[model samples]
Target: MRGRLIGQTVAVMAVGLLAAAIDGCSRRVTPEDFAEGEGATAPAEMSPQQERSSAQPTGAPEKAVTATDPGGNRNHQPGDKEPLEGVTESTPSAIQGGDSSPEPTTRVSRAQRTGGVAERPQGRPVQGEEQAGAVAPQVDQSQGLGDQAVEATPTVAPADAIPIDQPEERPQLAEGAAAADGTDDGRPAGASTAEPFNPLRAGRAGMGPLRSEGAGGEGHPAFRPASTEASHEGGRQSKKYDPIAENGPIFVGWPKPQLALVLTGCQNGYLEPCGCAGLDRMKGGLGRRHTFMSELRNKRSWPVVALDVGGLIKGFGRQAEMKFHTTVSAMQLMQYETIALGANDLRLPAAELLAVAAPVDGKTLFVSGNVALFKFEYGMTARYEVIRAGGRKVGVTAVLGKSFQQKINNPELEIIAPEEALAELVPVLKPQCDLLVLLAHASRDESIALGKAFPEFDVVVTAGGPAEPPLDLAHIDGTSALLVEVGQKGMYAVVLGFYQDEAVRYQRVPLDSRFPYSPDVKLLMVNYQDQLRQVGFEGLGVRPVPHSRREELGAYVGSQKCQSCHEVSYRVWRKSGHARAWRTLVHLDPPRTHDPECVSCHVVGWNPEYYYPYETGFWSEEKTPELVDVGCESCHGPGEAHVKAEMGSDLALQRKLQQAVTLTLEDAKKQQCITCHDGENSPDFKFETYWPKIEHREWEDE
Candidate 1:
């Protein structure tokens, strides 16, 4: 579950990773490598030896630490597990050496080693190291695999619970949580040593016991309220989940972006009902686009732009949606200079969308070559414009695909073969613009055809069509043109980077809604939540909850204080990354830092804290546990009944295991890691520096 986010650094080992003092030290045990992963820890926090370990060529930022726990030694499986059995470190194992910027290459999956046996059916080396028909082992076994692997189970829940001693930033619940008996019992707020805390009831109602309501007097769980407190605790030493601090927009020294395009609006039969793609809600807002775009822009000087290739929100019977779907809203938030009309966005009886987009302050430009202004016929207009930057002029425009003409509504909108339209236009318009950039909501096949139809064009940024994992750049008539897309609901954006001229080539970068937040955006999010809720989108399956999952647990608690005895886990919970998912986005202190833009994914507290006004940054009024980071409610569901169930002794380990549902094993671990790893969610997440140290006695894999 290695994640990608802006400013996250990877180690090439030694020179590649920058470890200052990790080599030659005795090995220590690290916490179980939960499927989820992290960034290199902060420099200031690294132990001298640990720092040296990072400087290795293996690119692994972390090395096993010297065992401090009374238990055996570090890096050994808890049950001994026979030294990982027959496995040995393989060759070309993603070693970073001194190189940080890795030109993207095909690599193997991490699951191959972590869980799934490597696909290799090993055979003896042909002769010696001499190659005969040796299939060089590919794919690194550390980063996990592709595909959102969700290990689904009947999710039982505990009250929103977190450790108290953790950073004030950790997620937590109320104090005096319930035991098997519903009566409030004392539980350690921050210790992982406490007995299993399970809820009394089952289903969503059973998770109440884990919530931490009464541990601290302030009602806010006890943890990092200020940096001074952390400084007092040996400066950076006491911090459990500390992030490695680094500066970015580092184009010259980082890996080029890997890109993907996913379309979501089409019905199985064609264009009809919308699909959630199984997501709880759709989150494609224009403002969000700006952050993702800015990140990609900062990644490379290569030209990058995202366009709504159409169909997204097309079925929204609402006026704003029909009229170019916040076309104005998108225009306002989407910083791209060019926009093409998706059939759904343009099929409105009236074209008010054009007016809405007409005067959106110059930076956002519009384009369409196949549609006549106010006519049902095809004619070119000043719809899209190109830019001459870095000595290259890339002309941008759009045309509805022929299939859309009168197929649905708005027969007045003319549609033509994309090839026909481009053929008629590119030659005539070729000299008018330097690079031809098409904003088509057409399918991938059509996009490919369009690219081939006109060798005159340079790049195609499309949306609205369904696609597979990710598509790379393709050549059309010997010129370089690439296809770009972002999955529906603003989940991701595909950024293409090209430099100098047509023959120079380009690379694709990926941008998603995971980055630091600004105050202004926070206020807007609050308003949007209310708006969506008012529009009946809250329980609409995937509509996002403005608060984190933890807050929901808090509100679920029936004024019963759950933090009387179980104090340790609750305290440690505060420092967990889960609690701070929302805060990182709005905090933004670590410029180009980690943060989460989506609120629904976080476990919130009982309180909803966020207010993003336009002019100002995230105002204090809008900040809350749900928006700030991991809260007790994240892991737990609402807790009122679970408290009662605990009062009844219904809590059990069996019940607890059934309740924690996540995409993949790695996904679940990643979620847990989100409680602290930096970059997007944990911008400062460092491996060797802050990775929990441990020791274990080897045992047979039972």
Candidate 2:
């Protein structure tokens, strides 16, 4: 009882101190104030290649703030009652069997806005409180941060009197439940524990992996998150619980000032819309995204912060270079605050990756916290960046997936686990910003694990892994952390709505026909194509040979050659989408003809690196017109031998040609369609549904 009273006295003293600290704040700390500090030293000037090879990894810890947890040793074990709100206890010199006075325990509250922190619980909603969306009072992004600061109110309790409540059980939706809105309690629809990952249906039902932090036994200091709902300064409900119904206006009568966080992932070098799906059906692209964001800010009056969760480009090849440049340029126009570096980005030689990371007009900062230039000491990116948007300090950090790290393979680079990186990072960053966000380019399971262990993150945006339905708003189990992943191929951009005193609402905005193409982006795409042409990938189209498959295939004998003998099939090819594939490239904003990346898919019988080994196979469009536009040999075995056989009188030769023709058609539906109509190029592609569109029967035609 005496110990308890002592703890109470200490708590009261700490609260009084906290109140005094807040009272002295002269001005709001802006992002600009924190932006100019230290980061990984840019590699010294040298050949780009040498810069990558010579740079040593270094760890530069942020200036240390006194550690907040009391006693320095608060390990929790299994079976311990975890507090809903985390408890921080600082010991006084006297409590340690010393002569100094007892230290007070301080409870820090979670940030509720994109970058707004409250000294006291300003807009926190209690359990079962009904809140509705309201327009937040607007503030310019550049200034006026101090006026919006919420005065902190210290909630005092005896250090030892912390509540011992079991963590709240996360509610789960029924199997196959409609994922239209959030759950009964207004949390994102909790995914079923049993649902397997399905990327194609992102923004729907899915569950990431869950890992325990091994906080053990009784008295585990499990930090409970602040209430999810926002509360006004007066501690009253701000709005009623009235969600915009499905099919309702996306932004009709938003209550007050709100922050819209727009996220995209797994672009994979797809800069243009795939014509296979019409405007109505076509889902994504930088153009549509630009249009959507512009309208939201201009039409809805919502302050928006945009981020890309990585997987920006498909590869590091020449073609991807063009796409990369174009994509980055588009992101700049869209005003992306940050782009997390994904495994695909790392595939580029380290030097090239760094080149990509160089600030684009000082608008986007590419980051990956877990990837080190070498050891765990120093790493890629500035570790964390705080950017101001919506008049708040938004802190962003990144963690590249381990799978990508393994692929990097360079001895000079080291990739650490996300949890390990966050262990050292979050504490330092948490004190610096109002709201914290993580760009986690990892598997769904890994991202979830990160969230569970680190509840300080306000939002965890993830990418990579198979394309699943976009489940943009999710709460990590046992914590209030929100995890969202936008599916691959730029099909949809997930929008997370944040109101001052309401639960964050999430929706996937399909970037389809409704949004017009951004003219600036369109012009940018055209300029990229022109740049490609200037580099000599012109008329013949720069198609690289797939050196790995060289041993198994025969090639060449252009499409025209096949047409001489198989007129009906040639005509059919001309009429099919395959025939116009090249034209699609040609018609794109500025028309890209020589891009090795774009060429590989539009033309037949080659990859981006090398040609299959065949005496008369396609070498160039001028040299092999018959091999152009996804001709007969693209799916059939390369026609060099087959053509020779057809022209020969040998009985064996004739029989072989016939056999080849029959087998080619038989294999068409299986290997032929899927090879090109893949997830990245044609997400909606289904052979059964698509085959009939181009099916041409020789007999029927005759």
Candidate 3:
């Protein structure tokens, strides 16, 4: 019975196979039948490549692709060519499964795959069908027939069905999601993985490394522009005749006057010019200012009434405190009668301010009408002071504006509004003096309003205005009060000369090189430098901070180490002015080696922008002799990593080090050079002219 059953099963199987073979032979198989999503299998005799080619969806055209060679040249394959507009070329790793080995592969653009039509739903109609209002066919996705679902969808290819050859062409994935290639690394799709470009890097093609702008990295101490009239060559004084000498006498046509009111303020802690570029280029300094005042009193033999509408220092710290004291002492030596405190001045500790304002030789020098310490008026400051000038009583009062009052955060300080303070005081003080002056540490508009509101003030010396004040005095509309603005950084002074019969002449004087440096002020500067040296950098409130690129670039190794491999470039730098920067400071009448402001620009390891030292920056000649002067590291960044890389046998590391130090000429012009050659220091600095002087390279033929 078992043998009969087996024979019957074998006969049934043979008949079924024979019947299927006959049915298949009745019809011929076509490429359309093997189209993707149709569920039709390829013929047994077809090769894998041919099978893939036939697997393409029906109606999709074959596209020609460009293959990249090892030399980066491209070769085109034979097919219908499609324009590759808007397609970014992918790396070999992106297309070839983490294998960067040079191998030719077809490159297909997103546009080519979609037949010049933007991707849409798989079965959705094109623009032509949409215009005709053709309805989309529905797909039964629940049936789990992938081919049927694909066939029912419209124009857009299924997102997951991107061809293996075009991985980069895949649609953008959600941010932080893995890409089709599985190397997204959490970055947004298509984001670059290379390091950001730094223009300041050294040895860069087309541009050389950075060069220090001034002797000491600090540049000019004052915030004034260089004089256009004067020009210097080869570090010498201008051969051209001095403009101030040829321009005839100052205050050109003003008649002889009884009293000269010399106005100066907004010193901003510039005791003297750095004089790095040349004295002729610099405009204002305390030394030059004193000479101007001295000439008014002794040379012209005119009675002088010196005053300052204050903004004494720029920054706050121990350095600022010292600068404040030095400025006040210098003002006293110039015989300034009154100094009005500005917002910047009020930032100082209240106790320190009171001490500075205290009377010297039984005479108060600082005055403010609205400010109070601990909510009560104290110290040497008074609401108003009457002074005898030009044989007439002059009433002077100062008020801090309401706008500036908001900037102060000290709980111990109390500030009354400028208008309110002036209102109460003006009524009482106006009758006592023949000339009334208001020192308004306020905005220009507020000053004008005060002048217009009270009309009793004869002159208003305002703090805010253009850096260069107008030649003529401004009068408040509908009021006789004159508005006087002495420009910022103490670059210019507005002198009001009062003569018999109330005749007042206005002269705006630029404290240029025409005025000689005052010996008295020079002594003060020497003393100030001495004080800074004793206090040291740390004592002056400056501490070393880590370099921004410390880990990658490493610590500075000076220019000498760089000299071994770069002899030609080193020789060029040796002869350049930067190498002799330290000598310039030492040769000055009063040596500035001890001065942090001067030393920062002249030496290595200091950040020129902040005027502070880096972790391994120059401190003193004895401690950091090798790091002295503006060395190679100033521009190229620290060289420890670069040096190690170059000395090693690794060719790849050497190439990377070379690239790391490279700087571009455009970057040097826009970023690196400006740090030192700013308006105040290198006023006559034009990159086109200056660059040629220090231009150097390893290969002269290039």
lDDT of 1 by residue, 104-205 (tens): 211111111112212211111111211112222332211111111111110111223312243332212123323222222222232111111111011101
lDDT of 2 by residue, 1-702 (tens): 999999999999999999878876744564324321111011111110100111112232211111111121121222222111111111111121222221222222332323333231111111110111223344332111111111121122222332223122122322333322232321223332111121111121122221121121122122111221111011222122111111111221122234567888888877866443223334577887887787656544456778888888874566666677678879988877778877777666666655656444433357667775544343334556666655455668889867566666666667777778788777666664556788988876677777777877767787743343332234455554566767778877777654333234455554554456788888887787777677765332443444333433344556777778788777766666676566565655455556655566666666523312234544456776666566666666566666777777897766655565554455776666666666545544566656665666543332
lDDT per model, in order?
A: 0.32, 0.50, 0.58
- Kindly list the per-residue Cα lDDT of model 3 for residues 603-670, writing each as its tens digit: 88888766788888788889889888777887778888889987889988877777677666788799
Candidates by lDDT, descending order: 3, 2, 1
> Which candidate leads the pack in TM-score?
3
> Which has the higher lDDT value, candidate number 1 or candidate number 2?
2
Of candidate 1, the 10-residue stretch with the lowest lDDT total is 200-209
TM-score of each: 0.38, 0.60, 0.64
Error of 3 at 501 (Å): 4.0
Q: What is the Å distance of residue 613 in model 2 from its true position?
A: 9.5
The C-alpha stretches of model 2 lying farther than 4 A from their native spots are 1-256, 276-279, 359-364, 372-380, 411-414, 464-472, 537-555, 562-581, 607-616, 664-666, 678-702
For model 3, the local distance difference test gives 0.58
For candidate 1, the per-residue lDDT at 280 reads 11
